[model samples]
Target: MTFKNAFMITLTAGSILASHLTQAGSPVHITVKNLSDQEMYYQSTSAMTQAHASPTPELLIKGKGSDEFRVTNPALPDVTTASLRYTIGNKTCEFRTSYIRTIAPGGLFSGKLNTAPKWDKKAISSGNATCTVTVTSTNFSDHSWSVVFTMK
Candidate 1:
């Protein structure tokens, strides 16, 4: 083939590959909903046990409102641990879990944490409280796993 033809072919192939890679690297959409009448504050911490982990920001959802965020390239380096803290009124509840590796691209795992989190009496007046926590891990992969925490 001529040099001009070869260059055009190569450029077209590179563009196609880049497009596919961009589509595959879509970010995970996270939604936090507060069903209670009281305003809720939340912060999430997620990391792989390796060096140089990114930090997540603290967020707030108004009373009976919902908030959404996107996580790009989640659950890096095989395994990841995450903690989510939710505060409503005078009560604060925390949920923690570790994400496991899965073989399938879209595999999902879920669990319910029905037990109450330990609370400090002086720090939080309502020490005896119960919050239903649900943990869901979806799109299991090395760099694309998404963890969702739902508290009620």
Candidate 2:
């Protein structure tokens, strides 16, 4: 084969392999929007235990504003559900949510969380709220997530 032809073939093969790896899956982006008149404090973290735990810092979003958290790994399983804990005013609530969008490989999904915390006068107030969400992607990787929001 001619040198030019051989080089072109090799390049094409390499491109195909690279595309498969990179296009295996798209990153996961979770968005939380504050619809109430009150401002909200929030944090997003991985519920699963990894070699290095994902850092989750507290954040605040003003009314009508939105914030996003992203997790990426094509090899990681698709997250079908997420746990959310939040406090509205003086009431604290914790609940598991299955409202995540179905994200296909090399595709993107955006899910909205607008559930207000329910009133419960039973459990003693610890001043802290927590929830455990379950996430399993296509690759069979399982991840637990905690996304907490509190009214400010």
Candidate 3:
């Protein structure tokens, strides 16, 4: 090869090696939003807040589908029912839930959490009920994602 061509090839090879030796690019990030209603319920039923107790702040992810949701939460205490209460206009609405997350720390359980939500304007007003969601976590860890939901 000609001297110029040879020099160009050598330069190209050196640059390629240098480029490969370097690391680059931005990192992937996961953002968690507290899309949770920034409200609180002092007196309630059918649902509880994530800050109620230890193993609390149980994250509830609401979504839509026939596929059952499965999560592990040991803090859930035994309860006949649990729910999430909200007020759409003057009407009181609730989402009844049931869960089968493993009770023992690290243990995994599976079941349906009250898959259906309930909305009763009278239930909320007559019962003097506040907006809330009920749940039972035998383990009671603050990291339980007890319920999952999707925004409309």
Choose 1 or 2, whichever is better by TM-score: 1
lDDT of 1 by residue, 100-121 (tens): 3334433244443232121111
| Displacement of the residue 49 alpha carbon in candidate 3, Å | 6.5
Best by lDDT: 1
Mark the regions of model 3 whose C-alpha exceeds 4 Å error after superposition.
Answer: 1-43, 46-81, 101-146, 150-152
TM-scores of all predicted structures: 0.44, 0.34, 0.23
**Per-residue lDDT of 1-152 in model 2, one digit per residue for the tens?**
99999999999999977776563222333445455576665434335311112233235667767565543443333323333345546544443333223434432334543322121111122244322222333222333332432222
lDDT per prediction? 0.47, 0.41, 0.32
Off by over 4 Å in 2: 1-26, 43-46, 49-58, 73-75, 78-81, 91-152
What is the alpha-carbon RMSD of candidate 2 to the true structure?
A: 12.9
Q: Give the candidate order by descending lDDT.
A: 1, 2, 3
lDDT of 3 by residue, 1-152 (tens): 99999999999999987665442211111111222343322233433322233333323322221112232222332222233344323334444444332334332455434322221111223233343332322223322234332112
